[model samples]
Target: MPTNGGQIKTYAAPEGVAVADAFLIYARSVDSEPWIPVSTYAVDVAEVNTTRNEFDKHPISVASFDMDGPVEVQVKYTLNKVQSAAIRPKSLGIQAVIDGDNTITFSLDRPRDVMLEINHDKWQALHILTNGIDHNALPSDSQETWYFGPGINNGSPYGLVTDGNLFVPSNTMVYLAGGAFVTFKLNFIKVCNSGVRGHGFIYNGPNGGAILIERSENIVVENVTSLGATGFSLTTGEAKGVTISGYRSFSSHGNGDGVDLFCSSDILVENCFLRNSDDTIAIYGHRWDYYGDSSNIVIRNCTLLPDIAHPIHMGTHGNPAKPETISGIHISNIDILDHYENQMWYQGCISLSAGDENLIEDVHIQDVRVERISKGQLVNMRVMKNEMWTTAPGHGIRNVTLKNISLDATNSQIVNPSQILGFDYTRKVENIVFENLNIGGQYIHDGMGKPRWYMVADLVPMFINEHVTNVKFILTK
Candidate 1:
């Protein structure tokens, strides 16, 4: 294990509540200076029934650090009164050992962010980041490259303004140096072959979103730490060939989705950390001017903590008149830390609610380890109509597969099981398969019971309405 001193910092919890002093470690690259972790306050957000409410006091601590290449780091934490401990995305193979001082040490490879949990579940989360970046060397001044060095320098039509927000044009590059603290959003509108990247911070005020890529193509946003977007952290609408990597975001506002894709195609989102109040990654069909089906989208190797909503949501919004279809989606190797929602119809860690006459199919969700479902279900696949959003019900949902999904509901009071339902006989869901689906170390198969039809106030374990057909479950020993 790499031993570095004082790189970690601890934040105190509430006045009376007992919490652990979390530690973070970072590996120094010979090519660059030592990485300084960003410390943010995490609040205990209560579940609201209708509208967005104010957050509780900042009782939890979150730390993030960046590193290049591969390295091993150890996180040491004060062991609280606990029964079990786990590092999220167990595929990372993090090893924990209790030191003689009664502290726990976690060892893992770098270039990823993981949530450290004590006992079976608690609210105090230590978000460790091992970020990787390219092109760290400063860029030379050129017509194609727009550089913003230390301090504020406004390049009227090209670079940031006095308030630090910049509207990037097409065929350009915007770079912010290290230690640069800029407070503005980056807007890429109808641009092509452009990128906004840096080690600097992008602070979105409490009104608009941070980054907007509308009707753009070949756009890239990487290695940026974004905080406090009233809207989405990154919103891509009617865009194509968009790639978002090595990004970290935190949103505490209502409807502040991490990455909302509307009618976008050929997208790849990987190696990111998102702690949002809404859906972390929402893939929707046509809406407003963005009118088309979304395809070939892949989101993997990420850590998602939806403090208020779903981690992966799809097919919620679409044009009822046009009726588009969303297909060819793959989500793998994800760690869902915590999902909180009170609305049963909109409660899930992974939800595919095909609404507004859309046909959502060909989805593959594999190797997902959900640490805790605080208030929602494991998986919810439904085809229905949202009276507030959709004009008509969805067409159907078919050929969706869930494999190697494990949920730890040990300390959860709401053990809401998964559901796969269709609207009616005319618009149904079919060809759904589950392989090695284990909840609290128990395999869910056909041997559980008959299909439990859901009603308004009924609380069932697992539901498969009659309208859902061709459901297969292959249990693993």
Candidate 2:
């Protein structure tokens, strides 16, 4: 119901949509406000999953921005119905069909308050469809993305006897009936030595998507560490007064997003470490299954190590494709040690290419360092570049700044043109200043064909047709 309409739209998820304890919503800044700041930008916003009841568990982590030093915030999940089960993420379907609708909703209380963030990998995941979900009306175009599916082999023999209780090893090979294991497969991460091998933390095959909270508020996630074999976790939904900090998350073999915010607002994440296979952090504008954008988010002083993909990112194509952009998110003072190890699987360090149809504005990435990176190392702005191929009605990436960046890499350049044509086509980068920024070594970015070397020195500051200015870096050789 964004009556002050420009190009964004919001909708509610249907009734009876099943969801767990965690959910996420990601958004990007739109409009040309190079100096206006995210909190002050004028734009459209929305939330997701407005049908089910939400349970705000005390977040395992909590931290505060706006003030110096480490300040603690009490975390809680806004709850509706109490089912003795622990909180978990909801499963989603692949976008292989034209109307492949798969989503959940969370009804909420008016008093819940939560904070927000984004997960770009989830946005990327939301874009392409899986084979099981693939029912496309048109034949494959050469430019179409490859489609996978909700890969799961639930009935396969994947258990073992441990301490008298049945245990599930991560990579237990299972036999599928018709076809092959590839079709009904559940892949596992090959953790070196100290992988997640505990109770309630087994590789639960596949069919996993997300956990959610709806219209939740006044929650805190503090001092929690639940990494490896974990999927989407520690969420606040459509609530105010939220905080997530001093926590650590591990990665699993499949899609694992840490600390998501959906249809929520006024959230903060600080002093945390995220190690997962997908997007470490994320926020959104709104979804058909849910409604709301991440607002007033401050993620600072954290360590992000996505076991598979980007350590930090935001905005999903579904949001912008609906002509709705994620908004008002800030990420700062973080260290990301990327292990881009999943090549045949994952991608990117930080990707901004959610969709070009909506507004992607007021994103501030400052004082960040990538301690280590591989070939397919850093960001992609593909979503904001192309119009015909993607969704979103009218959009641009403005007032986004990447300042005070220092990284230790092999061949990673600070920024580039090939992977991130979005900053090239839509807006002029202003105050996108980078000072005292360092880049080490060089390599090729894996998925989107972007380079991972200190290439920003080459592509940025292009006094050109469009990307005349940018998240520029002023450094010493």
What lDDT score is found at residue 267 in candidate 1? 95
Model 1 regions lying over 4 Å from their true place:
1-53, 57-62, 68-86, 96-108, 117-123, 133-136, 149-165, 446-460, 475-477
| Candidate 1 residue lDDT tens string, 1-477 | 112323322222223222225543333343334543333334332234464455532334454444444444444444355345577666578776655543455544456677666665545556655444433545445687777543333233334453545778889877754333355778788899998776555655434677889889999887776666777889899999999987777766778788999999999998888888789999999777888999999998888888788999999799988899999999998888777777788888889999999999999999888876778888899999988878889999999999988887684557576788899998999998888887778777755554476331132356888899897777665
lDDT of 2 by residue, 195-226 (tens): 11100111221333222334544444443234
Question: Which pairs of residues collide in model 1?
Answer: none
Off by over 4 Å in 2: 1-211, 227-230, 318-322, 339-347, 354-356, 385-394, 410-418, 423-431, 441-456, 459-471, 475-477
Query: Each candidate: RMSD to true structure?
Result: 6.1, 23.4
- CA displacement after TM-score superposition, residue 42 of candidate 2 (Å): 47
**TM-score per candidate, chains pooled:** 0.81, 0.48
CA lDDT of every candidate? 0.71, 0.39
Which run of 10 residues does model 1 get worst, by summed lDDT?
8-17
